[model samples]
Target: MKKKVLAAILAAAMAMACLAGCSSSSEEASSDAAETEEAAETEEAAEDAEAAGEETAETAPAADGELIRVGIINNDPNESGYRTANDADMKAMFTEENGYDASFAYSLKNDEQITAAQKFIQDEVDFLLLSAADTSGWDSVLQDAQNAGIGVILFDRTIDASEDLYLASIVSDMEQEGQTAVDWLESQGLEEYNIIHIQGVMGSAAQQGRTGALDAKVAESDNWNLVTQQTAEWNSEKAQQIVQSVIDAGTEFNVIYAENDDMAKGAVAALDKANISHGVGKDVIIMGFDCNKWALQELLDQNWNYDGQCNPFQASYIDEVIKKVVNGEEITEKTIILEEKGFDATTITAEDVEKYGI
Candidate 1:
């Protein structure tokens, strides 16, 4: 009877051990399943949050199809080929498809430009695109626009305002343009050449930039002589008049430094009428800026001399800035300098003109 009791106790012990082992194994499996489900849930939640963020970021501009009014203040469309091309570029970028409503005002005077800026500010435009007529008189206008909560962007011409006043400036370094032209002229090994420098609007950045290098050369070297220098006010007729005056005065000038192609064309027109030979490797060398297609063709046809490129197209880049800024993306640059090149009248081919001419 005692042996029977002992065997029953051992059987009870074995059954309890088996049950314990089974319970331990089941507990481990259940713990692993629970952990896997938790991990999946966490991952799914993270993915959902990421998707939400993307949609939110994309929704702001998508929802506001109302015209984001952008006001453009520029020099007159008849100013130059550069200005004309710039206007066309701006028009193309600010179309309905590009998600902006744009308006423009043109003036060659600072007061007029300031008035335009004030009007745009009153209209509550989202942004102001300014190509200032003069650099110095814009600080007050820019401050007013900033105070009114409108963003200002400088294009083509830069203002002398503090950096914080405007969002960004997309401009060609006018000083550098002049310097490049001077360097090219120096490379041609012309010494003791008399120059007739026809300037643009006297105090404007374009005129100031272009005249500096030549004036510096004259001041420093004294090898090249200034026959005559006059402000054409960037008008072709004024330019023609100035050149006619120079011709009538019997000025002994071998170099014509016109600030822009229009003035250069005007100078050349006077030269042609006076039966003066002008071009590269000719009796006179003409240097001009803003390589308009027609002006470049003149170079290709061996009529005009060197034509430097001043690319005036900036609206596409400005559009990119708008998309980034309005979308809350960080902008890496506050100033963008456009690259410019000088055309060698001796070697600039038709293909070069097509590819690189403004």
Candidate 2:
């Protein structure tokens, strides 16, 4: 009987040990499964993030494969008729149909443009296209873009940053434009150049370059005089006010060298108000830039003396540059200067206005 009791106790002890072993094995299996699931979830999250990035770049990929993400920084289109055509061309080029996922920002202020550029860098854009509002204060932004491995293309006006900062530039020779306009002005054989210099927005490339030639010419001679030199900030109303003030002060000015057509028109209004004859063989010789259709028409009609052509349509060239960037092709030219010309009241025609007017 004692032996039978020992046997029963041993069997009961063995059964308890078996149950404990099964329980521990089950817990270990559950722990292993949970770890595996967590790892898979982490990997999936990473993949989703990578996919989102690809989507931004390839929002509308071309037939080949990769998508080009571009950020365009420019000035307001409403600023001038020239700007209107420029912006429209850019819009037409960087469309979804053209395999580009482009974002655009427009501001007349340099600080605003810089801020927009920062955001584009943060968003990891593939390329940055800029038409700077100011020529200086752009080094920091360009450095940031370089650090991010993004390509930069400059269109319209250029900034004062180093050449290495940008991949390529498609721009007009603004200084040359000013020189051309001034040369034509010099050829007019005026008795004396009593000038009212109506400048564009201060610190702008166009303003600096256009003003440079006339300034040097004036400084070298005694016949040329500055009746009034001021900034109209690219507004026709402000330009009108400036000219009206000069007229009221009895300033003997016989020339209006406005940096743009709109300002020239404003100066013309002032002349008409005072019944001062202008245009061909008139009291004042008006010179303007940007060759807007109406401004060229004024030239054809012999109401304005000169109009300098500032080529605004650079979209096709920009598109070609961007394509090369995406395809890992080499850019041979760092700077691309557009062809431009000057128009005269005697030489301008209606057909010229229809063909070359922007």
Candidate 3:
């Protein structure tokens, strides 16, 4: 009976060890199951968050089937012929039919533009399209735009802002345009380079770039002499008065490098009033920018010496960029430069005028 009791006690101890072992295994299994469930939940949360982000990006403009809001700030449409084309292009692209609700503000003052941009930011526009009146004084506004998650696009001109602040820029290289004009001027084999440089709005991107090249070129050359340098503020009347003032002063300027066609026309008016013949082989050499249909005709008719092309139809390109941004696609090109050509009165043809005249 004692031997039976000892065997029974040993069996009881064995049963207790088995139960402890099973209990430990069950606890480990329960912990493992809990860990697995936690990992699955975390993964599902991440997926849902990612999907929500994608949906927010995809449906950015508004609720289903609503048009996106855009703010367009540009130099006044009355600023120049180029501006007229620019304004028209924007008007055509940012239409209700094109799935946009766009508001516009036009000014030649940078501070005014900054104010408009701030108002647009306050209004919560999805996109801000800029043809800045000036290049500087845009960092703060652009930073605010980044903060608000509004996409900014530059057209016709560029500005001093971080690449992160803007979506893309569609512009003509103003410096290159100036260089092309200067190179053509050099090719003319003129005896003297007495230039009357009538500039556009001071401190503007257009004025700066165009002036930079010519200024550099003049510095390197000994023959080039600027008889009078003045800003016309891109006004025909102001430009006319400028030329008239120069004429009254009796400054012996032979070449008129007017910044725009209107100013060039104004200079021509002054020359016409003075009976100073201008054109091919004339006393005054006339040059202008913005291939306005009428201006190009002047080149074709051999009435104007030269006219440089400044492309203004950047609205379509900006529209495409906005679409890509809205669709969550990557834009590889940060700056898209438009191709332009210069026309000479000597070489310009009717076909050339028709094909390229803006």
lDDT winner: 2
- lDDT (Cα, tens digit) per residue for candidate 1, span 1-358: 7976676566556545554654565455556657887764654454444344333323333444255789999899886678788888888777665557899999999899899999999999999999898778788888989999888888887778899999899998888889999988888887776989999988877789899988988888768888888999877788888889989988788999999888899999999999999887788899888898888988988887788788887885687677667768987888998878898788988887886566
Tens-digit lDDT track of model 2 for 8-109: 566556545554654565455556657787754554444443344333323224223345789999999998899898998889777775667799999999
Better of 2 and 3 by TM-score: 2
Clash pairs for candidate 1: none
The Cα local distance difference test for each model comes to 0.81, 0.85, 0.83
What is residue 337's positional error in candidate 3, in angstroms?
Answer: 2.2
Q: What lDDT score is found at residue 115 in candidate 1?
A: 93
**Model 3 misplaced stretches (Cα beyond 4 Å):** 1-66, 109-112, 134-137, 241-253, 351-358
Q: Give the Å error, residue 147, model 1.
A: 4.7
lDDT of 3 by residue, 283-308 (tens): 88899988888899988777799998
Summed over model 1, clashes come to 0
